[model samples]
Target: MIKTTFSIKDLENLSGIKAHTIRIWEKRYSLFTPERTDSNIRRYDTNALQRILNVSYLNNNGNKISAIAAMDDCQLEAEVKKHAEKGNTTNHSLQEIKLAMVNFDKNLFNRVFNTGLKELGFQGVFREILIPFLIELGHLWHSNTINVAHEHFISHLIKQKLLSHMEHVDYQPDEQHKELYILFLPQNEMHDLGLLFLNYELLSRGRETLYLGTYMTLEALEHFQNKGKKLVYITYITVDPTIKKVPKFLKQFEKNVNKNGNSDLWILGQMVAKMKDLKLNPTHKTFDSIEQLINGLETSKKLEH
Candidate 1:
């Protein structure tokens, strides 16, 4: 029931197939019949776009386009299934997810994620599929292989899914337990998928959380601290607070939240790992991955009692 119309550029961008070649395929092989707009401009629907992506994947992997076009849909699907079922590494799946992201194909992304999740489980999918996919996306964006719009589209989709999962968690607060973690990004940091998913994980464990979403100023934490409740201020420093600004940010954050003796700062992301002179305060800690951070929390709690 979903209408999936796409401009010619979207097809080209998503499939990595040249527009001219796509036209040739349309004319020569009768691959897809795209609808024409009022001005006679061609637009593709979701099904057509997905076919092109599948064809593109096949072509990229040494299948001849002419041969691919000659095959029936069932045959083509069989071939694609064989390739997909071959236990391709995480990198290959990441590439497919990136393509789906660019095209804004929720179906494709869901299909890919579900497939990977079935094979890898939630934690495995996070580490093997989602994490590497994000890293690759960042590299592509930084190198100008992908535009900012594509990055934003994909990130928003992922964030939405994480938020949906978070909503299903039943939160319970323990006054005696200093376990409620508030997660956010700094004012200039726009990345929230990492932080959002962390919230899902924490909430899944029956811990309480106050997610401030994204682009939050440090001053905002003061309001929460004023509540006189023990809370952990968790943040992902992917951008905005770069390595040079980390010491200053941490110093200021600690000074402000110091009034709440039970408060601590938990930071993660590439920027945190890259920091060399991270002024270590007793109330601050840096983690390389979400798993490490969560494990550390569990270990800390065990040692507390």
Candidate 2:
């Protein structure tokens, strides 16, 4: 069996239950005590993580810890599903998916994705489950708790599913008439999954989008220029060209995009968001979230109709 071992800290991170609280639950309520390492450190298994996650979810949702402590395994599971059915299963799904990533278990990953889709639908899964999972994955990767391979395993799986969802959605000919949105990632940035999903979001909302994908330079994007069609350009600045290089990147980007006054520039992602000294091109707008940008487009679409 693939190792599903986790430390108390991992349990704390995954369940949102502090280590001290978990200890109290163990001592006072006998919440499935974990096995001790040779060093006497608590080592939690897959089932323990699942139980604590379930307990954490129920407790957060108004179920008392004492009541949860009194319940049998079946009763606890019933309680978890009872509240989980009311929605907000992303937290529970996160742990399962995390295990799937660590083990590189494709079947388990598919099951988790399918379950999320059934519970929350496509957009809900993306916003509620997938985004939070990515955040956690990033932390694990950063802390060396998980490797880049593990990160890519989960990421590629999500990418495939997102593309599948996009492909399956029916788009009318009139939807094709919507304004062209060109999406890309700036040079040296390979994280294009977010951009790809945003294409789905735009396309689903009746907007025509051309996804140029990763490692695109401003020079390369100029080809989409002067097509006599006013284009809404979108790109992400994610760990590419470095922070100090952003000013220069924007300057070069301005040289190309600024040539066309009618072309609109939209910049997204964390690198761009956190750059305090970065200068935006004269022809650019920044969005805090994809939801904000999509809502803006929806509002504009309504006004035009």
Candidate 3:
């Protein structure tokens, strides 16, 4: 069964509106008419959520709450569309992307994504739009606002876009950068979208990278062999490698692949970030975010020059 009703907090989270302000809008502006529960708590339907998002978008774009409240739902949505067409603010684009996901509308998703690319460029779209959208998507998933299918649908679409962009980035191995960056996801870890984008960034910056996508094992690294150049193995552990197993996995990786120190491991994602006591080998490193990892790599490259 689908979750059609949401609490006031969900509305605030999804719309970026304050719960107090939502209450005010309910009492003063009559903007929302959320139904009350048996105990008098408020419950809002999907339409209310969409309307508040639209109102937030319009109000952020200079429309007054009084004026927004006066407009009918059609007018409010029209105003939002008009403003969205004029400019691609991060918030507005995020809302459109969320709606696209909820409705499973490929055309709408493409339209918003393409618009963002045109205005923000690929990196900007990813940093400003897609990243935040994905973060919120996670929240939605945990809140039960969306199911796994929704997550998969949107993830596949984003992956396709990332792959398409990556294909355009042609990089020949630079003699100066002898370090080969190999990106992958650990075994049982299927979330590779972040790693995919990281590969694009690496390739775009002229880093020689081999993307050995999801469900990879440390033993698999042996196949690549040490060709004399340093092999920098990178993986984003969004899931899998449960906290208890991360240390064991790292130790196994050291034993299996990096025993000679010919390779270095760069671990990332929420999993490792939460492991406050994680000890790393002198050659290994941990990054809290993609940006940090990218900056570290770029700095290393410059130092090499």
Ranking by TM-score: 3, 2, 1
**Candidate 3 steric clashes:** 0
Candidate maximizing lDDT: 3
| Model 3: per-residue Cα lDDT over 1-305, one tens digit each | 44578899878777888899999988999998889999999998878878998998888888899999998889987888788777747889899888778767789899989988888999889988998888788788888777898799899999999989988877766678788888989888887888898888888878888889988888988766656778999988766888888889889988898867678888888786677686677777888878888888778878977
Count: clashes, candidate 2: 0
Candidate 1 local Cα displacement, residue 291, angstroms: 1.2
Local distance difference test, candidate 3: 0.84
Number of backbone-clashing residue pairs for each candidate, in the order shown: 0, 0, 0
How large is the C-alpha RMSD of every model relative to the true structure? 6.7, 2.7, 2.8
Q: Candidate 2, TM-score vs. the true structure? A: 0.87
Question: In model 2, what lDDT does residue 284 have?
Answer: 77
User: Which regions of candidate 3 deviate over 4 angstroms?
Assistant: 1-10, 18-21, 35-46, 58-67, 74-88
TM-score for model 1?
A: 0.69
lDDT score for residue 67 of model 2:
95
lDDT of 2 by residue, 100-154 (tens): 8877889988988898878778998898888778767767766666667877888
Candidate 1 off by > 4 Å = 1-80, 83-89, 121-123, 170-176, 226-228, 301-305
- lDDT per residue for candidate 1 within 146-221, as digits (tens), equals 5777787778777766666566656665444656689888888877777877887787666788889788887767
List candidate 2 segments past 4 Å from native.
173-178, 275-279
Q: TM-score, each model?
A: 0.69, 0.87, 0.87
